[model samples]
Target: MSDTAIEHYWDTLVTPYELWAEPTSARLASAALDLIAPSTGSSVLDVAAGTGALALAAAERGLHVRAIDSSSRMVDRLTERLGSLAGCSAEVMDATKLLYDDDEFDAAFSVLGVMYFGPATMTALTEMVRVVRPGGVIGVVHWARPVGGGPMFLPLARAVERLDDPEVGTLEIPVTTAYLEGPEVEEALRGAGCTDVQSETAVVDSPTPAPETFLAELDPFFGMFPQYRAAVARHPDRFRALVAEEVRLVERGENGHPVAHANIAYGRVSH
Candidate 1:
């Protein structure tokens, strides 16, 4: 997707996007922070930050944060979030071409955003390498597996596949998941000049009252896929019914919680 297109899609849905997503993003941010282990007071940059999830996490640990996103609305939401945290800031900027000086930050990261950068993915990775000082940490957390955010969307994907509703034209699953796998991301990390590249998978819990409500909980994000938005707008009841029916496809854990996983890839700029 073009940067402008992505910006518009996210800008229009910022409110609901954060409503459910911010909490999960924040959980993943904590995992990223635990892996990178930067010292307190170090300068950290969050690339393509959506609503300052990682920024807020870093700030809570006494780090200085700068977050950027292509969408001004996202930056607006992010800035408002960082207002209480002194020495933190947000801006609207392109991730592939950072505006700061070389070796400017002690660490940098992007959580599930850069993989969607498409053709510019490598440029964004290299730019992260450039802005972080030699020996600084760089991390990116992405949805693990070929289906992206994993089975968290399985109900929707299954529903779309089963529906085959003519009113919705064609429903294509999200295409950015391939870039999110551990090896693919680790390759990108090393290709960008990062050393000691490592990868880890962590389970991110998505709690809901019942399995069927998964789509209801994350409808805004799926709304970005116009087919989903149109399908639901036109056939709210039937569409949700199909989503609920497909809930059987998801692999639930012992206590019946939605178990999604994220891949965190991290490394140091060669000393």
Candidate 2:
């Protein structure tokens, strides 16, 4: 299922969402620009641009950017973040069916977005291909796996398992997210007619002011993602306790900050 269709899931997230999410997205954006290498003044497109992370990053490099999201509220939040930035704009639009002309951009990127597209990733990548000029580059970032890099929820999941709580046994996050891999993303980019495909891993440093404060800030995300909803619904008290333990471990290991490794898959199909 394409979870991006859930507008309220994204709409309800704005400043709070960006507070923690942007750090990861920003790291992904840096890796993306390193991959795409768009020069200053090059036309760029950010698909599924949540709070304009990649868009804002590109703008900092002097690239003309147009950020699009399916959620109106996301676009509004991004627009506010982009105040007074010339040659940059944010708008609500479907990523699978981009409302733009062919060969319109020099490069395109999506950071920590488009992975939720699930079956629609191909459509989104195809649209991105159609809109970029021949030889133009496009990339999409997705949560890879637990081996080389783990998602933020990994520690919490372990904490839940260690507690032997029958109520929270086997938390079910979305199937699409649990097993997402770089090879899967590479296949999608190839299926979209992109050549010279490449996939690599990069560390995402997500900052935290303090363990408890970070937990307080992350409360909103628990309601946004399904696995969190499942855990909270099953036994809110147990899950909260589990997260508390995870926070302690995080504090000890990484100064209370969390980190994730994301897959960056990028390629270009000559139009």
Candidate 3:
């Protein structure tokens, strides 16, 4: 996909994404940071750092954080949120085409980003590995396919596919679905020159007051593609019903909050 399209898509969803996706991404970023373990004086890079969630977390941990995203709006938000953070900076840049020198960072990571690059996923990973020092860590978090079933977004995706609009019908499936399995993530990390790779599913309990609220929060994904938006606009009631049914299928927690699962895939760069 063109950078313009990707930027437009994300720019359109930035508000809702910040309100909804940031919480889950923050949790995942924390997990990745724990695995990375960058100390004071460490230089870290946050690729595709939408709204600076991971970058802020790293800076809070005392790492010098440099964050980048393709969407200028996202970068602006990140910059705004990063105001006066002495060691943090945000820039508009593409993950696949990083502007830093080799071994520029002590560690690099992305949370629920980079995985959507389709054929460019490896290119982005390669750039991440290239920029970090040989012994640094590379961490990623992506959506895991439900065991014995499709992803949580499959119902919505199927609805989009049924629209038969050529633009939407041919939209590439998310790269995470093909690589969230431990073995797949491990192989990709290894392929990017990471050694001692490790990956696991991290089940995050996202508790919303009700399913409707949960569905609303997920607008970032469901309303991502233009065709999907058109479809939703064409059949708002049907879309709501479908989402309600899907949420109903989810197991509720003791506090009545629905749980969401994510996979954290990480590895150390080879020395």
Q: Score each candidate by Cα lDDT.
A: 0.80, 0.76, 0.74
Question: Total backbone clashes of model 1?
Answer: 0
Query: Residue 37 in model 1: shift from native, Å?
Result: 0.9
lDDT of 1 by residue, 1-271 (tens): 5657868988876876576567677888999899778999999999989888899899999999999998899999889888878789999998988999999999999987887677788899999999999989999988875554545566676677666777776666666645667888899889899999999997886533245676666776786677788778887888888777666544444223466678899999974
> What TM-score quantifies how close candidate 1 is to the native fold?
0.88
Number of the top candidate by TM-score?
1
Residue-wise lDDT of candidate 3 within 37-148, one digit each (tens)?
7888899999999997799889888889999998889898989998988878999887998999998888899888887666788999999999999888898877775321
Candidate 3 minimal-lDDT segment of 10 residues = 146-155
Worst 10 residues of 2 by lDDT: 146-155
TM-score of 3: 0.81
Candidate 2 shows a clash count of 0
Alpha-carbon shift of residue 161 in model 3 (angstroms): 11
List the lowest-lDDT window of 10 residues for candidate 1. 248-257
TM accuracy, model 2: 0.86
